[model samples]
Target chain A: AQSVTQPDIHITVSEGASLELRCNYSYGATPYLFWYVQSPGQGLQLLLKYFSGDTLVQGIKGFEAEFKRSQSSFNLRKPSVHWSDAAEYFCAVHLTGATNKLIFGTGTLLAVQP
Target chain B: DVKVTQSSRYLVKRTGEKVFLECVQDMDHENMFWYRQDPGLGLRLIYFSYDVKMKEKGDIPEGYSVSREKKERFSLILESASTNQTSMYLCASSQDSSYNSPLHFGNGTRLTVT
Candidate 1:
């Protein structure tokens, strides 16, 4: 079984400041990691995904995440966050070659201050 | 861009009522899924369909059922609407299986059971 854990329940950052959200996972084999963002009263949108090859993956909205195998972590980061970037971010893990079910973390709510 | 459409943005139902939530995907995706989002719980999968008429139980499938008569359409059914089922229901679809492909989600339906 695969599971995900997000230590931070909520985080507040100033607009144009650097942002980082931590995520950790526990899976048996190589994992497919993904970051998704959901705005208020909206569905989730894919931010980025990591399968193999590059450890550092760039996503839309100037968001990026790095997959650390040793740390079992895939953390999302943004150099400069905008006010519109305030949303709930989720970290999920999928087992390669298994059922397409994704185990998601508790999520981290980001609040941007102007 | 992939477009996943959900039938309703909000719904209110009484306890013991039969509730139906419909979802459709324009990308002809083979996989469709239903998930509920709560405050602490990010997204809990209720049911998933890999193909037409092929439904699989997800982590929380106790009071929920699903139907997939066509490749691009999936429906989630609440046999008996309860207050606990009141949450944001998200519908998602992927080209192949969700495990390997990034999922596209609908705006979501907020169901309020009283």
Candidate 2:
């Protein structure tokens, strides 16, 4: 079965520091990877996605993710963390089949400290 | 911009009662999905519809049913609500099943079954 794993359950980073969130996936085929962020009491917003193009994908709010095929990982990175960046981040893999569903990882919650 | 709207922000229901959760998408998307968000379980798909009057079971569809009578609306039904069903239900839509198409999510409905 295909699965996604986010090892870090919670992380606290000082404001203005760099941030990196780890994500790993297991799938048979070339995976379509995505990263989404959810704020408290709000819906999730797309952060970035990795398709068939370059290994590095850029997303909204100054976020980027690198898809490493050998490692089967897609890690999200931001140069500088802002206070507003405190949220839950989820990594997902799109499965192509009869249903074409997405499998998500247990999210990583980021708490930015001032 | 695509907009996915969930009918309720919060709901409380009694056990064994039938429950209905409504979702509407303004973009006339070809795919609509229902998922439950829980602590430590990022998001688990309940049901998804690819077209009008068509539905498919997802990863976790044991206690849920879905209806997609129209192109813009999809409804999730819980035949017998239970305390275990208390969760944050999210509705999402996508233009198509393309590998790159991103999902647009609605502000979730927090359902609490007592």
Candidate 3:
């Protein structure tokens, strides 16, 4: 069984400030990790994913996440957040051979201040 | 671009009503999934279909059923709607069950049970 944990439930950041959303996962083998963003009244959009590659992966909207095996984390980061970045973000993990069953974290609500 | 469409954006139903949530994928993906998103619980997989007419239970499948009669269509059914089951339902599709493929999601259907 695989599971994901997001330490922060809510985070507030001012516009032009750097932001980071923490995510950790527990899986037996090399896991497929993904970040998704959901704005108000909308479905989730894929931010980025890490299968097997460079630890630092870039995604849409100038977001990036680093897969740290030693820390068991894949935290999403942005150099500077915009007011439109206010949304709920989720981190998910999937085992190698599973039928695309993703184990998702509780999610972190990001509030960007103007 | 891959597009997954959910039939309803908002639904109101009474208890004991049978609710059908429809999903369709424009891409010729072989795997489709249904999930429910609740506050404090990011997303829980309700069911997934790997191929036409083949459905598999996900992490949270109790009180929910699904139908995959065709390759492009997948339906999530609530046998008896309950208040606790009221949540935002999301539909997703991926190219295949392979680990490398990412998922595309629909806008979601917010169901309210009263």
Candidate 4:
């Protein structure tokens, strides 16, 4: 079965501190990994995506994620945390084929402490 | 930028009532999806359409149906709304279901069943 896992249900980081959110996936083929952020009462926004090419992919709002095939992990990281960065982060894998679907993790809620 | 627009922000419907959620995408995307998002359950796929008039069931398709008569419009219908069906419904579109395509989501509809 194909699935995505976000180990951390919630994380708290101080302002200006670095942040890392773990994401792992179980897939059969080459996975297209993605990180998305959802603010309170707002829709989801793409943070970053890794299709192919370089393992490190950059996304909007000063976010970056590294895709590791060996470990089946695509971890999202940021150098500094901001108050505005607090939101629900989701890790997703795009399943290839005619039905192209996204398998999502339970999600990690990030709280930035000022 | 790709724009996926959902018709409602907040909706309140009574139990056993039929509900319709409309979505439109300005980007001529070939793939459109409907998902229900909850607090701990993350996002569950309800239905997806790869092309005009083509529909496929997703992870959770029970009590839900979809319509894609045109290339840019997709609608999700709930045969009979239930309290458990109250959730944040999101609509998304992608250029294709391929690895290169990342989904663009709408503002989401928060539906409440009474």
lDDT of 1 by residue, B1-66 (tens): 999999999999999999999999999888899999998998999999988999999989999999
Question: Which residue segments of model 2 deviate by more than 4 Å?
Answer: none
- The prediction achieving the highest lDDT against the true structure is 2
Those runs of model 3 whose alpha carbons end farther than 4 Å from true positions after fitting are none
Best by DockQ: 3
Candidate 2: C-alpha RMSD to true structure equals 0.8
Runs in model 1 deviating more than 4 A are: none
Q: Considering the two chains of model 1, state its CAPRI-style docking category.
A: medium
lDDT of 1 by residue, A19-95 (tens): 99999999989889999999998889999999989999999999999999999999999999999999999999986
Clashing residue pairs, backbone N/CA/C < 3 A, model 2: none
TM-score-wise, the better of 1 and 4 is: 1
TM-score between model 1 and native: 0.97
Q: Per-residue lDDT tens digits of candidate 4, residues B74-107?
A: 9999999999999999999999877777788999
Decreasing TM-score order of the candidates? 2, 3, 1, 4
User: In candidate 2 chain B, where is summed lDDT lowest over 10 consecutive residues?
Assistant: B94-103
